[model samples]
Target: MKFTERLWQDIAPIYNSILKHGFVNELMAGSLPTFLFQYYIQQDALYLADFSRALNLLAARSIRTDDVLQFTQFAQNAILVERALHETYFSIYAIEPATQKMPACFAYTNYLLATTSLQSIAVGAAAVLPCFWIYRQVGKHIYQQALQENPYRTWIDTYAGEAFDVSVNQMLAITDRLAEQAGAAERQQMQDAFRISSQLEWYFWNDAYTQNQWQV
Candidate 1:
């Protein structure tokens, strides 16, 4: 069987189920503290720098194409936007950025760089899909839930921000395009990467929740 077929086969169920669950409102809100704790407060800039360099290495050859160029632009923009959050967190906590050690965030970002560095674009798409799709779904769900609960207004407001939605949609559209153009084997590789990354995302969150046990 082709990689795409296998990849779709593996994730179709989980993807469908996630869409079905309609994103957990409470869970999404609850997750904000952990996200802040991990990415903004604890994560070191070196981690992002390393991950960004890894991506640059992977795209060195392939980034000549217009599509690839656009993707890289998106990535650069994303890093900028997310980094702003880190700055905000630093201001709020008066925490020196030097002491932060966001292992889980680094691990997740590293996984992306490592996979994309060695794998094809299809594989890179798979590695990245989870982050895009999960965030969109989570954001949408949280926004809907916020209509009633009114809890975590800041969290709801952040995810519901137009910029975040735009980025997620743009990334997903890119992934869809890549998947459509990919050959069977490439698709499978992409799918495999996606499944692993998806599960890894959940685990990363779990890791954030259980801070202090972080090793990598």
Candidate 2:
């Protein structure tokens, strides 16, 4: 089996858990409180700033110019396309984001940046793939029950739509190609990064559902 396929099987339970996550259920039902969604989007905006940096770092480390350019464009999309959704949410909700990152948001982004810097470009890429890939899956799942008047419809549509699917497919291809050349140990490390980030994906929504606030 392909490494990415195996990695997904390993995290099957977590992926399933995400589909049942409260935030998602609430979102599809059109009952998620606006305040909680606001909190999630705000931290997401802060989170993407660092995410784009992680992508940029991988681009800088790329031995292949095409890889470099691809990563650079992915980095730009993180800010330009995805974060634009958050910016629109900010306007609709009329809430100013915290000047600081929320706890869960900080942990996930820092882990991605640090891992990518310390590990292979492949591992770095693996670390960040879940954010893109999982959200595409989540968006597809949630859109099934999305009401036309759903307050979060824009966010849902952004992820569930074709353009986002194209991005996810590109990232998956990149990971599989990296996996093709990786040794067993490095492959395991890449899977570890993927799994950890996947789990963090769940925790992010859970944290938002509970509206986790910074203690300080």
Candidate 3:
């Protein structure tokens, strides 16, 4: 089996948990409170800013020119398209986006930035892959099971579309190519990075689910 396939299988439990997360379910069922979504959108807008920078670090460290170009564009897309989507909701919700990161939010994005800054690009690339790969999977799954009149239909459709699938496949191909030339230790780092990011993926949503606030 391909490494992506094996990787997915290894993380199936986390993947399944994500699918069953209350935030996902309520969004699909059209039952999620608008206020919760508002908080999520606010936090996500902040998260994407950091995520885009991490992509830049990944692009900078990439050995291959094509990978560099791809990751740069990935960063651009994250900044442009996804943030535009958030803007639309920001207007609707009348939310003022904040720069302050939720604890879970900072932990995940900082992990990516620090890892890419300090480690092998192979491992850094692995760290960022879960966002692209898992979101597409979650999008497709929720699109299938979601309520026809789901309040978050546009979000579901944006993620589930063929365009998103193509991007996911492209990232997977990049990851596989990296893994091909990786040392065993590097490959293990890749897996470790992927796993932690996947776990954080769960917490990212849970933070939104709870609308968690600063403890101070």
Per-candidate local distance difference test: 0.60, 0.90, 0.88
Better of 1 and 3 by lDDT: 3
Cα lDDT tens digits, model 2, 36-58, are 89888888888888999999999
Candidate 1 residue runs with Cα over 4 Å from true position: 1-41, 44-59, 98-103, 147-155, 212-216
Residues 1-216 of candidate 3 have per-residue lDDT tens digits of 777777788789999999999999999888999998988888888888888999999898877899899999989988998987888888877888888999889899899889889989888888988989999999998999987788788789889988778888998998898899899888889999999999989989999999888899
lDDT of 1 by residue, 24-98 (tens): 433444444434353434543544554455445545646547655756665675568657766665666565665
Alpha carbon RMSD to native, model 3:
1.0
Each prediction's TM-score against the native? 0.71, 0.97, 0.97
True-vs-predicted CA distance for residue 200, candidate 3, Å: 0.3
Query: Predictions ranked by TM-score, top down?
Result: 2, 3, 1
lDDT of the structure predicted as candidate 1: 0.60
Instruction: Kindly give the number of clashing pairs for every candidate.
Output: 5, 0, 0
